[model samples]
Target: MSPQTKSKQRVRDHGEVFTAEREVKAMCDLVKDECDRIDSRFLEPACGNGNFLAEILTRKLATVKKLYKSNPYDYERYAVLAVTSIYGVEILADNAEECRKRLFALWDKEYTAVCKKSANDETREAVRYILSKNILCGNALTLMCVDENQKDTDKPIVFPEWSLLGTKLKRRDFRLDVMLKANDKPKNGQPSLFDVPEEIRKYLSINPVTKEFMAEPICEYPPVHYRKVQENG
Candidate 1:
C-alpha cells in the first residue's frame, strides 16, 4: 500500500490481526522482566493504540494475581495497585477515551473474577471506583484544560506559586487579601478601595496601556496555613 493509503487505515481495529506470536511473546516477556527487575512505574505518554499497554497490563495483572493468590481477600487491592501503577496519556481525546474504556474492561474482568471467588459486591465496586479515578483524559504535551473552550491550549501551564506575586513593593505589599478586601467594599461612601488608585495607576502605567496594563503586575499570596507539620524526630 502507498504511504498515503496506509496512513488512512487504522492499525488497530478490534478484529485486526496481530501476527508473529513468538516475537510478540519475547517482547512482552522482556517488558515483564524489566518491570520485575526495577520495580519502576511505567508510563506510555503517547499510547496511540495501546498495543504495548495491553500486553503490559496482562502481564502485570497476572503477576499481581499470582502474588496475592494466597490472600485472595486482598485481590481488589492488588488489582487497583496494578492498574494505577501503569499510566498512559494521549493527546487525542478519542484515543484517551478509548484507552480508558480498554483499561476499565480489563478492570471489570479482573473484578468479576475476584468477586466471584470472594463472593462479595463491595470489593467489585471499589475496583470500579479506582479505575474511574486513575484513568483520565490528559495530554502529555499539555495538561488537559478543565475549561471546555480551552481544551486545545498548549501546556495549560501554571505560573509557579512564588512567581504568582510579581515582586514585593517597597512599602506595604500589594497582597491579594488587600486587593480582594478592596474589591468587596461597596462604591462611594468613600471611593471603593478596589477602584484602581489613580495615583498608583498613573505612576505604574502609560497613557495608551489599556486594561492589559492594569493586569500586568500581579501577585499571589500563599494560602492561609491553618495547620503546621511536626518537625521532631
Candidate 2:
C-alpha cells in the first residue's frame, strides 16, 4: 500500500497498485545479474513513482561505483549510461513526473557521494535531461507519447538510445511503434525486423552500430568533468 495513489478512486479507476519496496527488491533480485549490469536497460510500462526503477538504479549505481571508483571519468560516463538505459511510460502525468524525480534523486545522491566537490553542473543537467526523456507520460498500450496536456497528436513515443564511445556519448532516437514492429516477420522472403538485410545479419551480429541499421541519434554530449572546470577557473 504505497501512499502514492491519491485515493480509492484512482485505484479502482486505473487499477494502480504501487508495489511495496520489499516486493520490488525481491522481484528484481530474480534478475540480479542483469540489474547489476551498468548498461542493461529496463523499461517499466506502468511505472508508478518508480519503486522498481529506483531499486534497479540503486543496484546499477552500486556496480558503477565499485568498478570505476578509481577513475571518475569512466565512472561518470558509465553512470550516465546506466541512468539513460532506464525507460518508463506512465499514463498518469503525476506518476510519470514523480518517477523521473525519484530516479534523478537516487542518482544524484550517489553521484554526489562519488564525485564529491568535483561534480560538474553540466553533468548533472545532462542526467536531468536524460531522465526527462527516458521517463515519459504516455499510453504504453497505444505506444504514443503525449504532450504536457496529455493529448496524443499522432506523435509516436521516441526514445534516445545511448552508446558510450570513448569520451563521447552517441545517441539515437527510435520510435516505439517502429521498434515494436521490428519484431514482426512480414513474409516468407522478407528481411527480418529492423530492416537488417539477411546478408548483413552476420556483420550486424558483430557490430550493431552500423548507421544503416539504426536511426540517427538525436544528439551527442561530450564528457564534462567538473573537477577540470574548477581547476581551469
Candidate 3:
C-alpha cells in the first residue's frame, strides 16, 4: 500500500493524507456504475496522490477494454476519453505531479496491453498532456492555482472540458469558481438570460434546459484530432 502520510509537515500544513487503497476501492465500489462508464466525469477536490482517481480510472479503462479491445482505434480513443473524464485539484505541487505520473502510468499500462503494436508516441503524449491539464496543482478551497509553496495565486483554477467528436476533440476552458456557481439559482430579483436587455456572455446566461447559470468557457479552441490535441498549444 502507498504510504498514507508523506511527512508530518505536509499533514500539518495542508492536511495531506492519502486515502488507503482498500478504502479507496471500497468507496469507489459504492459508485460502481459511474466508475465503469467511460465518459462519466469524476473530479477530486482534495485529490492527493490520486488514490480514488486511480481506482476510478482503472474501472473506466476496464470497461473501455471490454467493449473495444478488438478495435485498436476505438480502444485508443476511448482510453483517452476515459483519461479526459477524470479531473483533480491537489494543493501540493509534488503530490499533484506524482498523481499525474501515477495515473498516466496506470493508463499507459492498460493502453499498451490492449492496443499493442498500434499504440503510438503521439497518443502517449496526448495522454500525458491531458493528465497535465486534468490533474492541476491548485487550492480547491480558494479555487485558485497555488505557487510552489502551496500558497494561493491570483489565477483561478481553470479546467478544460474535453468533448470527443468522432476522431476529433473540442476543448473549452472554464473557471472553477464559475463552474461551482453555474448551477446556483438566479437570485429572486436578479436578471436571468431571458431578462437581460444588453449583450451578455452566453455562459452567464441561464441555461434554458437546466434553468441554471451556464458555465461558459473562458477560451475555446476548434476541434483537433484526439492525438493532435497538444497542437492547440
Q: TM-score, each model?
A: 0.49, 0.79, 0.92
lDDT of 3 by residue, 2-64 (tens): 388978877788887778888999999999999999999999999998899999999999999
Q: Give the range of the ten consecutive residues with the poorest summed lDDT in model 1.
A: 224-233
What's every prediction's RMSD, in angstroms? 16.8, 6.2, 3.2
Candidate 2: residue 22 Cα off by (Å): 1.4
What would the per-residue lDDT of candidate 1 be over residues 51-129, giving only the tens digit for each residue? Answer: 5566677777777677765565555555555654555555445555666677767766875675476635554444344
lDDT for 9 (candidate 2):
77
Candidate 3 stretches with Cα past 4 Å from truth are: 187-203, 208-210
Cα lDDT, model 1, residue 33: 72
Rank ordering of all candidates by TM-score, starting from the highest = 3, 2, 1
lDDT of 2 by residue, 126-200 (tens): 888888888988888888877766577577677877676665666657666655545444455344434554432
lDDT score for residue 109 of model 2: 90
Q: Could you tell me the TM-score of candidate 2? A: 0.79
**lDDT of prediction 2:** 0.75
